[model samples]
Target: MLSPRRLAATAALLAALTAGVLALLVTAGLITFGAAAVTVAFLVTLAALAFLVLIVRRLDGKAHRIDLRIKKYEAELARTTTALKNIETRLDLLVQAVEDSAARRADDLGAILASLGEDRVNAMARAREVEELRAEVRALARDSV
Candidate 1:
C-alpha cells in the first residue's frame, strides 16, 4: 500500500546508501570507484522505474473508478428519460380523451337544436291547415241556407 512518492524516495536513498558504502570501502582499500558508480546508476534507474510503475497503477485505478461512476450516472439518466416519456404518453392520452368528450357533447347539442326547429315548423303548419278547413265549412253552410 505504499505510494509512488514514498517508494521513489526510498529507492533514491537506498541507491545513495549503496554508493556511499562502496566509496567508504574503496577509501579503506576494498573496491573500485568505477564499479561502484555503475552499480549506483543501475540502482537509481531501477528505483525511478518502480516509482513510474506505481504512479501508472494508481492512475489506472482512478480511471476505472471514474468509468464506473460514469456508467452508473448514464444508466440513471436513461431510466429518468424513460419515465418522462411514459408520463408524456399518459398526458397525451388524457388530452385525446378530453377532446373526444367535448366533440361528442357538441354533436349532441346540435341534434337537440335541429329537433326543436323541426317541431316548431310542424306546429305552425298544422295551425294554418285547420284555419283553412273552418273557413270552407262556414262558406258551405251559408250557401245551403
Candidate 2:
C-alpha cells in the first residue's frame, strides 16, 4: 500500500494532469472554456477528497498498530515482574538455609572444642600422679641402701 504522503503526491499529479488536458481541449475549440474550468474544478475536488481519505485511513492504521504494541509491551512487563518475584522468593529461601547451616556448624565446633579441653585437663592430672609415685620409690630405695 502506498503511504499517505505518496498517495497525496500521486493525487496532486493526477489533478494537475487533468487540468492541463482540459485546458488543451478548450484551446483547441473542442469544448467551452467555462465547461472545462468546471470539470477541472470537480476533478481537483475529488482528488483532494481522496487524499484526505487516504490520510485518515493511514492515521487509523497507525493508531491501531500503536495500540497493539502497547498491549504486547504490557504483557511482557507483567511476565518480567512475575519472574523477578519468583527469583526473589528463591533467594530468600536460600539465604535462610545458609544461615541455619552456619548455626549448626558453629554448635558442632563448640562441642568438639569442649571435649578437647576436658581431655587436656585429664592428661595433666595423670602426669602429676605418675611423678609422685616415682619420688616415693626413689626415697624408699635410698633408705634401704
Candidate 3:
C-alpha cells in the first residue's frame, strides 16, 4: 500500500542505519574496516534492489489499471456499433414502406384521371345531341308557318 517514494525512502534509511552500526562495530574492534566496508556495500546493493522492485510493482499495477480501462472502452464501442446497425435496419424498413405507399397513391391518381377523361367525352356527346334537336324544332316551326 506504500508509495514507491515512501518505500525507497524507508529502504535508504534502513541502509544508512545498518552502515552506521557496522562503522560503530569496527571502531569498537568488533570487526575489521575492510569487512565492514564489504558489508556496507552489500547492504546498499540490497536496498537499491528493493527500491527497484517496488518501482516495477507500481508500474505493473498502473499497467493493469490501464488494461482494464481499455477493455471497458472496447465493450462500449461494440455496443454502440450494434445499436447503430439496428437503427440503420429500422430506417431501411421505413423507407421501403414510404416507397410502397407512394406507388399506391400514384396508381390511384391515374385511375381518377382516366375516369375524368371518360366523363368529359360523355358530356361533349350530350351537348351535340341537344344542338341537333334545337335545329329540327326550328325547321318544323317554319314548315307550319
Separate clash counts for every candidate? 0, 0, 0
In order of TM-score, best first, we have 3, 2, 1
Clashing pairs in 1: none
Best candidate (score: TM-score): 3
Q: In candidate 1, residue 7 scores what lDDT?
A: 69
RMSD of 3: 2.2
Q: What is the C-alpha lDDT of each candidate?
A: 0.86, 0.88, 0.89
Candidate 1 local lDDT, residue 72? 100
In candidate 2, what residue range of length 10 has the lowest lDDT sum?
3-12
| lDDT (10s digit) by residue, model 1, range 1-145 | 8766776687778777887788898798777877777877887788778777887998999999999999999999999999999999999999999999999999999999898888889978988888988889999999999
| Winner of 1 and 3 under lDDT | 3
Give the per-residue lDDT of model 3 (tens digit) for 1-145: 8776787687778778887899799999999999998987887787778778877998999999999999999999999999999999999999999999999999999999998988899888888988888889999989999
TM-score, cand. 2 vs. native = 0.70
Q: Is candidate 2 or candidate 3 better by lDDT?
A: 3
Residue pairs in candidate 2 whose N, alpha carbon or C atoms collide under 3 angstroms: none
